[model samples]
Target: MNESNLGRREVLDEVELKKLNNIRQKKLNQMDSFEELSYEQIMKMANMHNEILNNIHMSRGDVYLYSENEKLELVEDLYNTYMSDFRDITLKQVVDFSKNVAGVEKSQDLLIYDWEKMYIDQANQILFDSSDIGDLNMSLDKLVGDVKSDNRKMFKTPILLYIETLKESSFYWASVEEGGSGLGFSLLKKRSPYFMSNKKGKKNWKNVAIADAQGMTTGMLGVAAYGAWGVMFGPAGFALTGGAFVWVAVESAMASALFG
Candidate 1:
């Protein structure tokens, strides 16, 4: 292995390299699924408006008829679903650029697997008794159908659609009180490779890290912008922020798409 001024390379044993290779292969498979699945298909599976709204409520810890444990579990399930989709969408793009555009294989992969069906099942089971959150079950069932169906072709490359899902899913993940902070940070760090590898994204991941940190600052500012209005104007401010869960997601989604 050779080291460059860009970053030091650590030599890995054959076993380590093989494990990493396997992980990258899995990412390729997930990416294949992501490309086949269209934005319209995902939308048809679930109502984005409601998903956004419900996520806001979940973030505020205001979900009804569910215990803290259940809320945590449900939100985790949703988070995994979004991340699975994200890895397929984002990492796939990175890998493709490496192989096709750059004539190189970056050899990147995520520890996550595409368990879309498992996520749907867990969500349904968690919300089985409640009618309110259960409304989301329709979307979940739709997603299950999309996952199970052999024919999935909604659009060629609806880049923004997956971004929307990623943002919304992260919102839900950040809603849970237990591991919200950790999950959010993990997501941002793990996803840095997309920017590091893609032509549109940052070439230097260190810069991506800096941008992500700054994004957190701006994200808080976005929260304050909405929060300040809510403090003075009441319902109208709440309307803009959508009940406390609308912090910086729009920016994050835009940033992800542009950087990816």
Candidate 2:
């Protein structure tokens, strides 16, 4: 393309980006009026997400093995009984358990978070990077094998977005469970293929957290929104999860639990 053509393409890209951003912002605004959640509510939100997972048959176990206030005597028995369950998820106990079970190193204690990110990043690279098989090409099974052989998370963007969608769906499911509002699982269940490509439908979120991060899907923009927080007040948007994919549930517009 000529320099003039290149300049035009860049302008087009910028315009497209702005349009996507506006759609995302509108969806995020829905949760702005919600109040902050309490500690017990946080626990319930997390547990409810796990319960949703159980119903879906994605995983075998259920959550909520430990309560918010409890004296846990650390012992072989404790480890044997609850290690499989991530039972120490309430408040300070979560940190303490991570430190104990994951070992003494500071990074080691945050291994679960690190591991989750590592997988997501790798998936994004593999699906979106354009260097690998997905030049809109195929050969994912081969690339997956290479991750163990060469040891890398490689893929293209759309596929990575897909991995993100599956990861975020649980939290959205929990939001409706918490009485936040919107369509919840009914909405989320139908949108999985859309985020992978406009041909399939639209965009959506890949994460959810209450703190300084973001997830959830945007049906309008067709691109994933992450790395920012969209707060959900009251019993909605589980706080312990660490980010917010705040609102968004579809294509014409992203729906979510209306706060305030």
Candidate 3:
């Protein structure tokens, strides 16, 4: 071959070598992405597993086993248990749970408030108007009275609200059960696919908030007001009633001032 041909061959060889190296590097990176956990990460995972097992045992009246061997075995068992029931837990629950575990508070509340504002702005879309409002209001009032009479009632008494809370707790516990060492990627992966997509997550939360707020504003408001009324008239009825009236009046005035 001529010198020129040899030079060209050399250049082509160099290019091919560089391309091969790039391909190998890409493969190595992909492998590393799925690599086994580091010692420190493993230890953290073990600790979390132990904590979850301990909590579960405590709640179930079972003896707390602290031995490293026993804890690891228990964690593995829990992981298996969760995997078995994975289908039972909905994607929506996973998303809600993921948000809660991330310390996103009043997530539902913000959505509800926004939805309420939306409804007020578009009054034509109002499903139940002032006519059926009385019955709805009365029912809510009774509910509020029942809850107030039993102070043990939680703020998340509504079915949907309670489900949302459950979803949050489930996601949190599921992450701990899994070999995740407080890593966002693992937790996010375990979350609902709907939640993983930002668009769907926002939309789902907004819809839930809108529905919840509608019920609360119409039916729930009556219950809350009735509860407040009961409290006002409980024992120190005169002072409480006067204070309650003033408070309601002030709230109405402020709301009118801000939005009306």
Candidate 4:
């Protein structure tokens, strides 16, 4: 575990962690039906333009006409639909990279199961592999798709996607590095190997403690970035750090992906 100073950032503590999860769940429960989703809330949820989304659904009032299960289905349908926004870091953008990206053509099980470790030995048993940094970057960008089309387009709420899902699914399981480009969140299953083992009672808890602390920073920054820190954390959640969780999540990949 001594792999070059694991981390040094602060993260949410136990009480704050519980709060983050609870608030996130509440957001989901409140969405038991999309009937309640407001124009503003939708705006907050999606970073991309919704002109296409708006055309498909004439009005918000029309959304509630569907039955309860239909509401969830509606959300899923929207979740699955691609708005074709140009900023989308989609598969089509890097189709050419398929010839060069490592593991780009491998089966899904193999990709996720291997902890998404990049092929370090791409030399082909040949000397001087000449791949550049751009090659590595392209390989990573398209890695998150649940399917080919959805690879780079599975954009969803940062509130629900990153901090919301990971805290529960990972069970505070520490990650020395992020698993992948956060392809998509699994509503029905916990991600494998991401939560692979428990490190309870490990002899050296320094790294664990450091990881947890940095996580708190992420969570705190998350709510703030979600623009709900004031509402969810309230005066007390703010006081915990004498205005806790107010720090910007500018660096949160999950938050920034959906937010910025």
Candidate 5:
């Protein structure tokens, strides 16, 4: 080609370079705007509540049954006492009572997954615009974490608590068989306070279990909040220190509401 033609081609190449740069800059600006949106706070609160439910179920057995026909009429009075004396207490109160009754001196240990590590790794990938494969894997990891955490903390122990409450009530009384195939029912005589005391101990254990589950579920909320923010704003926004600070604040609020 002639020198003039070569010079024209070079100029056109420079114009294309400028256009590419402008496009890149525009995309970066859009990303920045997207990152500014925040909503992790709400998700954090939900997760905390889930934790409380899980803890309660873990500590308490599934159910308590009483049958006069089965020579277990004592359970009837216990159920009545629980209903009448303890029904109005909060979950925390119930848990505290159980702990005292059981003489439980230490907190139960719990196993927790490191969801923040996974989230951080994913955030790095999202910021870099890495392969879609990588993003998908990270998303999957987060979702699995959320599901497992939630399942671990649901209200699985309330039925048992309800049964125990009934067993502690005074309404359940013993009965005696009389003449003409008649059965005379009456309360047990010489009731022991130790029996009542032991019942309280069992209730305490159930309460601790509930508390632990609550804590775990609350932690999950933190994970979920981070995930939601990362997904909605893209990794870059979530990676920002400001985003993390906001997440922490939200998490703290949720924990307080659910477990404090």
Candidate 6:
């Protein structure tokens, strides 16, 4: 071959080699992630996931026969168990779980928040309207319907809000459970999906957390003052409960100041 032709051939070979290397690197990363997860870790994730799923189903009725305090501990234990095992969850793992274990077409089915969208939207609207307590409870009951519904998208905002709320006040669930406030515990658990997504490393963790916090706090005080917490937990009930529930009281006071 002429010198010019030889040089062109070398350039083409180099480009092809680079592409092959990139593909190999991707496969290596995938294999490493798979091998990094132990059988115990996989079982742990699956067990916790199943617990959450059962909780969602139980939330539909009075099947949870334990005292409010017991329920609180149950939820906290579940959170700790899941968080302790938090690792980068891959799409392949989720798919495998869905197909092999859940017998569902999509992993999203297993990830659903178990609540209805219309109820959440309506309850949120009423919370900001200074509505009567009866109305708020009624709306909540409607939102947490019997059958498991698939609305993971609708839960994103609520999960983010709950995370921001929890990050600011670590003992929120404990306080609610101590105070025997079933409504509060149920509300706190709504943030489960955010943690699930975090485990999977779906987005920039810092960015997702900050955005969730900002979104939850933004204009929250103004709307909260309209008797949202009060309606949900009863007049002065949330304020009386100390510890993590303090987040609610603080926000409620700020909201009261803003909208009053």
* The candidate that achieves the highest TM-score relative to the unseen native structure: 4
Error of 4 at 248 (Å): 5.4
- The C-alpha local distance difference test score for the whole of candidate 5 amounts to 0.27
> 184, model 4: CA deviation in Å?
30
Candidate 1 or 6, higher lDDT?
1
Candidate 2 ranges beyond 4 A from true positions: 1-91, 95-122, 125-141, 151-185, 188-201, 206-260
RMSD of each: 21.3, 20.1, 28.8, 22.4, 27.8, 23.4
Please give the range of 10 consecutive residues that has the lowest summed lDDT in model 4: 121-130
Residue-level lDDT tens digits of model 1 in 59-156: 64333345435533533444344545443223323222111211111111111233422342343343332233224335545544454453433221
The clash tally of candidate 4 reads 12
Q: Model 6, which residues run further than 4 Å from truth?
A: 1-120, 128-130, 146-148, 151-260
Report the lDDT tens digits of candidate 5 across residue range 91-132: 333222222212211111111234333333333333233223
Candidate 5: worst 10 consecutive residues by lDDT? 178-187
- lDDT string for model 4 (1-260, tens) is 11121112243345754564466446545433222223233223222222222323343323323444553344333323442232232332222111111111211111111221222112111112113223322342233222223323211222122222222212222222333212122210132343335532121122222222223233432333222232323323212222121111211221211111
TM-score of each model, in listed order: 0.22, 0.23, 0.18, 0.24, 0.17, 0.19
Please, what are the lDDT tens digits per residue for candidate 3 over residues 91-150?
Answer: 333222222222212223222234333323333122122123233334434433443354
lDDT of 3 at 74: 38
**Model 2 weakest 10-residue run by lDDT:** 1-10
Worst 10 residues of 3 by lDDT: 1-10
The window of 10 residues in a row where model 6 has the poorest summed lDDT is 1-10
Point out where model 4 deviates above 4 Å.
1-10, 32-132, 147-260
Candidate 1 runs further than 4 Å off:
1-23, 26-35, 45-60, 63-160, 166-260
Residue 85 of model 4 has an lDDT of 39
Q: Would you list the C-alpha lDDT of every candidate in the order shown?
A: 0.31, 0.28, 0.29, 0.26, 0.27, 0.28
Ranking by TM-score: 4, 2, 1, 6, 3, 5
